[model samples]
Target: MVEGDTFQKFMLDALEIRGEWVRLDDSFAELCQNKNYPESLRKLLAETTAASLLLTGTLKFEGRLSIHARGSGPVSLLMAEATHERAYRSIVNHKAEPFESDDLNHLLGKAQLAITIEPDKGQRYQGIVPLEASNMGDCLVQYFDMSEQLDTFFMFDSDANGCFGLMLQKLPDYRSIQDQDAWDRVTQLANTLSFEEVSGHDNETLTHRLYHEEQVSLFAQEPVRFQCTCSPERSLASLNALGHDEVLDILEHEAKVAIDCQFCGAHYEFDRADVNALFGLGKMH
Candidate 1:
């Protein structure tokens, strides 16, 4: 009976600040059903998933956005992707350790975070988000500073099963000094909110609690779910990269070419007939 996964957009009507709120519950648990990740890593993955949703709402596009971070520390890689329509999926690659820290330098080491935007009909774009921040949301916030675009702020919280994220970006070029002052005051009020208020309560209650004096236009919530875009046809096309001869060689040693989807844990196997059909190698019997 939980209205588990949803993404909502809202506006501080009087302040010219646009914001988004996202919560992932059943869909989040479904995404992790196949993997056995430690609780800490699971929490990180949940945050990344929520971050991906919030970021996707920030941009106006017809494609998907991917949040990817990699490092040589206890955590090797974490990635999450969400499409424009709100369909999403996420995964993480990490060691099963608790990231024990005798020190900070050894725990998190050198890491890089990149956010990639791939449009459905146009060229793809990627930005490097600073990974030095203490958490995922702050790391993404540094991206706006580096670009010198809109002043963006993010608040994110998550546990092992679910996560929530809020993002607010100032509208370009305030019309008046009052509007400018309002932006500062509004962001200050927002920053004062605790993670529990931001993530635990619904958007309407949370927004009113923070900005009771301002007019808010709360939009309808959109559904977000776990969806993996893997198909056997796509997997078969990947074999083409290896060429016919190589695929035949792989079939020589093994019974069939096997492909396993890491995101959804779906298994795909290509036998001699499947290979022959793909490579135009007529009749491999």
Candidate 2:
């Protein structure tokens, strides 16, 4: 099996198109290990995670990019986030029974997909689109076409072993007659990619097989890992957000307050002294 948990960028020199490939093995396993998700939900979450990373690779920002979905189905909510540094986390909230179908529309029934780009120093940008396709790849392609006015192609796959994705996008300069022809040809070739080829082969072999006649430049691979941004201080800040009275009410009822990080399952506990310190008062015995 190919070593996973890395993102690599490549440029089709002759086609004026750029692309990215990502594979998640141990990182995917780590993210899913702690959660008790049905198989259908697991696959959807994995695809979302791969899509988030693929989109994040195209941006030159210092913040995070997130893909979110909400619907009126058994799977009510699904979310995935990837930072500029390539750290990622994902979650799925759904009803307990195993889904009988893996179709995106059936699993997500009447869902809306939201893509948000948050820069470290600027206002966040978001685009919303209805989940109109049978799969995530087609839905994202539709989003870019309608929202960004760019031609894009996406292929993604995930199973019990790992998850992987490939994306090809026509750059803005691809407008000439020759460029248009090249774009069409490259996208057609990209469309022929099978999940087996994407998840089973290494980057070099895969790209070469797909675009052997074109001049392709494979860039250095960036490492991607599973990481959660949860800490005691952050949890305390959340408690403060609920107001002093609310915190006291919870503490009075439970004797101690506990908060769990949804991403990594880390637990944060607060006793009376902890709550008092958060409110700028001296600790109580």
Off by over 4 Å in 2: 34-36, 276-285
Using alpha carbons, what is the TM-score of model 2?
Answer: 0.91
lDDT of each: 0.80, 0.87
For model 2, what is the error of residue 121's alpha carbon versus the real structure, in angstroms, after optimal superposition? Answer: 1.9
Candidate 2 lDDT by residue in tens digits, 1-285: 485799999999767789999888998887778576788888989899999999998787799999999877788888999998889998888876569887888887898999999999999999997988888888899989987798998887788778888899988777753755887788788888787777668999988998899999999899989999889999999999998899999977898899998888899999989998999888555
* Candidate 2 clash pair list: none
TM-score of 1: 0.87
lDDT of 1 by residue, 1-285 (tens): 134799999988767788888888888877777687766667778888888988888667799999887778887777899999999888888675676542223334587788899999899999996567777777777887776577788876676667777788887744543666787787788778776665557777887887789888989999998899889998999899889999999989999899998888899999999999998867556
RMSD of 1: 3.1
